[model samples]
Target: MIRVKDIITRINSSSISRRMGQGLVWSFTGTALAKFLTLLVGIICAHILQKEAYGEFSMVRSTINMFIVLGSAGLGVTSTKYIAEYREKQADKIPAVYAATNYFGLLMAIITAILILLGAPFIANNILHHPSIVLPVRVGAVLLFFSIINGVQNGALMGFENFKAIAINTLLGSVLESVLTIFGAYYFGVNGAILGFGMGFILIFVTNHLSINKNFSAIHIKKLSIKKLHLKDFSILYTYSLPAALSALLITPSFWLIRSILVRAEGFQELAVFEAADQWKVIILFVPTAFSQIVLPILSSLHKEKTSFVSTLKYNMLIVGVTALLLSVGVMLFGGFIMRLYGATYDNSVPVQILAISTIFSALANVLEMAVYSLGKMWQCFAINIVWALLMVGCSYYLCMRGEGANGLSMAVLISYVVSFLMFLVYTIIVVRKEVK
Candidate 1:
């Protein structure tokens, strides 16, 4: 019924709306593509290697990630927060922040590497129940250096709002990792897969270093003076980031503990099933994880503007809730098909699928948690995350002992999110309400 001119106007308005609506979509798509490539590499490794071999690889990777968290010392996040704040006022200070963060991150990485190398034998024999993992765990320790460097560079790039570079670097690293992993597994077997992962981290480190150097060439390394680094700046950055870092340290190990329990109680086959389900869960998180990255800089900028923090929080919740809901539905519908991609052994049962799909809530909770971090409510975020991690351990132990098997493990994860989400909701409401008044 509308005239052609009116229709054109309406079309233009809709086009604008679509672009706004697709903000999360675009970010998620880029991340999903990168993860898909990485997952394809995983798939090839799974097929080429035996179940025990894949299980061993997974165990070593988890161990490496745990230590890497400590090595990072939360500097990446602290850098992002401080860099975002300082970039507008004293743009010159940005390089100093970068330099200080890199120095600290490297120092922490060395400490963590020493501890990991010393404890590798204990961890392999006791925690993983696989003595063969000792060598690979040591090999993965080398990644800590590269990871620390990459973290600093990524934080700086994110602060600068260089999403295109961030996305490209991630994609290229993932693709290269995939290719190298396939080749490594083909020629070198399980140890080769571990080597390939280390190589991937190295590639990312190099790419990010070059990219950051090219963009900030004029900033000059001579301008970065640790002697000029003020305690006040470090305190502020630590106050804002310490909670999130502690929370990550506390929470990530819970998964490894859960796996340890399963391996000790049930056996490697059960661990294999759990690993397969966990992989899919990680894949589904690719989109939400990417969206969180985009959201962080925006929310940080809004906080700096002294905008209504509650409004920003609500907007983030609304967007994340909707996106999470749609993605959850899709995952639930197609999860079994996706699991079948791993192999017939991993097709799993109905209950396991249902429990795994429940992780959508967990992913949504993560997005909300990030929003809180953006608002500088890291202490509260830390409290909630720790509580969730504890609940996960308790529930997983009880369910596994009660004979729930992989389903119990999945249910434990789901319960942790439910409790954590409720607690976060209460905390957010109380805090935001007080701010409103």
Candidate 2:
């Protein structure tokens, strides 16, 4: 065993190790609080709403989430990368970058709104096969504007390493959403749940907007004029961002396709099982989501310095792997009990239980994906995501057609995640090796 003095000396040698440990603690606390509140809200919704309604809600939310990626246009990520680089150079271009990108975000939001309005009916009727979803889908479309702006502001904050602000925004949004959703759903049912989600974003957007304005008073509206925007600068942003945007669109929307297939082939009950399992998986994902939020900006800064990418990758992998292992064990052990919190009916399905357990692999993959993104390997990430999405869609279709029910779908999910994780691992190894050499 190592002596206490030796351990203390080792820890003192690396400032990064110390900072990372602190970041992890803060991140874990914020994530846990946010996820807990969200999970509680989900539990309330699951108990109050019928499984069919819950499944429908999940489908609609997933569809709207897909559009969020478009509204974001990967600018948030690109902003973080560039802002971190600029800060290191101690350049005064920060205000200009912010001004330009905010305008870009607005433009993207406008275009997204138009696309949503034009395609709302078709998406609801044909794609989701639920014309009833049209109204909520349209309402959620308004959120695209809010989401885009929020992304930009949050990206900038992350670049400055303002984790406290980020944490506040996240926690506040989640808490407000949870309280509003629970009370709303209790009174007005499923539509209330949807409304609460919309309202939550609106509140977050307003709060963040105010905070940003106060913090970055130098970045005035006049500074954000389109006339001052440089096409060359915009091109640089797009060059870095397009892959991330494409990857998000390809990967995220595929969930809806799987949901649609399940609805058509297995009916609402099986869909409900799938959604239940997926909810638990989302809870497990909060760990990685929080980690990514903190890691990306740090990695972006380090990358600009031409640091040891291999060591960074190894460190990230170790932390993520250990976290994933603990979460997996916890989730697997408590999955049945967790399901019971949703409702007695949710605990009936063994396959759903198994699916929730499989989230371990998915969570690990998500963490590794974040590592890849940090290295600015968005093209590789995009390619791998597309391949995985295609495979998931195919597997989902085949399983649904075969009438294996929710269990079959779960198996497909497990296989898809395993494949994606392995692919990400191989790609990460190659990229890290190249960077080191």
Candidate 3:
């Protein structure tokens, strides 16, 4: 058996550890600035829009976001992996990879926008049951096209480790979004709020696109390999993105379903409270997310050569587990203040507490899910997530029917994550050990 002392002594020499530190420094800086900006926007918007209207506004934005992920087509992710892998070894291939990813993502996003535009009536009137926002939903389709393409750029930048450009883009985008949201809400009420939301995403796309071109000037139209690109290469890219897009297609509706269930059970007022607290969930998650971004490309590049990923996993568990605990405590103590940002109606704290508690398990799951992705096990993670999402819908529905309130829904989400974390842990162990064999 490996001895404890030897394991402890060798920790300092791990390459992943060193690289993690480097990636974390950059990622943390960007994530911090970006999340802070998002938080400020949410707070101000909540303050400006009244309770029910604020709820409606959040619903429109969240629903739009849910669909936006579908456009990623996994190529957004594959770009980062392929770019990182080939950056030094196959430098000429960079332009081909970039062009393929960008063009493919943009194409898919445009199609997605069309679909959203066509379905906005059904979604707003039927699924959302909030026909008042139908116009906003239609307007949001344009934003969807832009946002999905932006994901492609951001993913490519992540591959190049040009986090400074990514950070600046995010900071600028968030500030613009906040200003517009506040101004629109102040003037035109709910419709203005919706305008700000959609326009903000458009600004994000423009800034990110410009930033990527500025940072990676090698990929101009003249330098790209579009003329030489073959059908087989596009087919290969399609294969990479199919599973991701499929997952997004399923997952986005699942999220929409949960909010739908919650609103149906507890009303839009409670949904407002739930959304308000979720911002903090986003805040706490920024830490693990920063690490995951760094780890994905690293793991993708090194998966074949092999090393002990378990050590790094342990280090993350400690860091994220403890951080989650602290965050839960912080929310429990001061959650009221957070909800109060929305107004007196949101000041209820049970949902906030439940949501905060869930982040611990969710954070751990986020790391493992990404690790699984790194190992090329995308389908398993997706299957597992689909089940978890269903559980969120089913469990939340069953419990809320019993009069457990929004807390019932929140608890269901928390339980689903715990189950997911356990499943991922076991499956990952089996996969890793077998790989060694």
Candidate 4:
């Protein structure tokens, strides 16, 4: 039997273990605080805005997230994978990698932002079927630009293992976002809330930019620009990012489509209940998310070491599984009370509980997905996400047509993740066998 004392002593003795412990502490704390602040803002919005209005805000937010997948072009994970792999092995090439990533990242951000801006009217009118939200959707284009830039920079910082900077940034950004969003929802309703969201992303982008500059200088990179594009490094990034982007294309838009179907079939009031439950899901997810962030960097560095990589992956899966089970239990126990915080209108508990169950599946699947990324097998990642997306969207559309509303959508999400987790498990086993051979 393993003893707690022995485990603690071992963690204290190993350098990598010590580093992971520190990163986990900072990442989890920062995520907890930030998620709390965002949840607070969400509660405030729910109280201030009517159910229909809050539903509209959720729709706009989902739409922007969908657009952001295009803007980011999967450069964030690509940045993290390459930076972590190269920073220690080929330190001299770090600058070229960073420069090429930033260049393409910026180019994609600008192009997607332009597309979102020009197409906002059409999206609002046709896709969302809420022409009144055009201005907010347009503002989200600005938000998408800053968000994409910040994502690449955030990934780079994580590669550097500078969790302290990320923690500080999360704290400051969350505070600012909370203030702006609360104030906006209280005063001007949904549009103001979205504008506040944009402003918050902009602030984080500025801070992340500063962090990148410092991280670069620490690594002896004199400047952080592409003076001459390195086609080799860019090609490598592109190869990885394409499948990653395609995976995002499959995932985000499927959720967006799910929401669209909900609104059209069941109306905004039902969407509001689903959105409320989703907030709690986000809260439950913060812990695993923090773990996944740490896992990516460590696993990326260990990818070439088959034994270490496989061992670490098993450990990560164990930790995530245990923690997620506990959180899901808490959600099941307190889901109704938690939903009531959003407002009486959100007091429905079944959807929240169903979503809580999904969190367990999601947490484990996410860890496996991150491992695939660390191994640089992104096409496999895309394939898994495509299957999950098809399952989710198809099930959701059918249920929405049956007038199931929040319960149906939540069930769809749960089923999709469960299937995705099983598939990831199979793929990981296959990869492990190949590594052994």
How far is each candidate from the true structure, as Cα RMSD in Å?
A: 4.9, 3.4, 2.7, 2.1
| Candidate 3 per-residue C-alpha lDDT over 254-358 given as tens digits, one digit per residue, 9 for 90 to 100 | 767778888887778878877887788888778877766776676666565544555555566666777778878887788778777767767577888888888
Instruction: Note the residue pairs that clash in candidate 1.
Output: none
Compared with the true structure, what per-residue lDDT tens digits does model 2 show for residues 182-301?
A: 876788776677677766676668776766665555433223557766677577466677898888687767877787888889777677777777776777666766666666766666
lDDT of 4 at 203: 81
Prediction 2 TM-score vs. true: 0.89
Better of 3 and 4 by TM-score: 4
Best-fitting candidate, scored by TM-score: 4
Q: In order, what lDDT does every prediction score? A: 0.71, 0.71, 0.75, 0.84
- Compared with the true structure, the alpha-carbon lDDT of candidate 2 equals 0.71
Candidate 4, residue 279: the lDDT equals 85
Candidate 1 local lDDT, 141-231, one digit each (tens): 7766786667767877776656666777777777777887788788888778887877767888878777777656643433366777877
Name the regions of candidate 4 deviating beyond 4 angstroms.
Answer: 1-13
Per-candidate TM-scores read 0.88, 0.89, 0.91, 0.96
Q: How are the candidates ranked when ordered by lDDT, highest leading? A: 4, 3, 2, 1
**Candidate 2 stretches greater than 4 Å from native:** 1-12, 213-224, 304-308, 348-353
Worst 10 residues of 1 by lDDT: 11-20
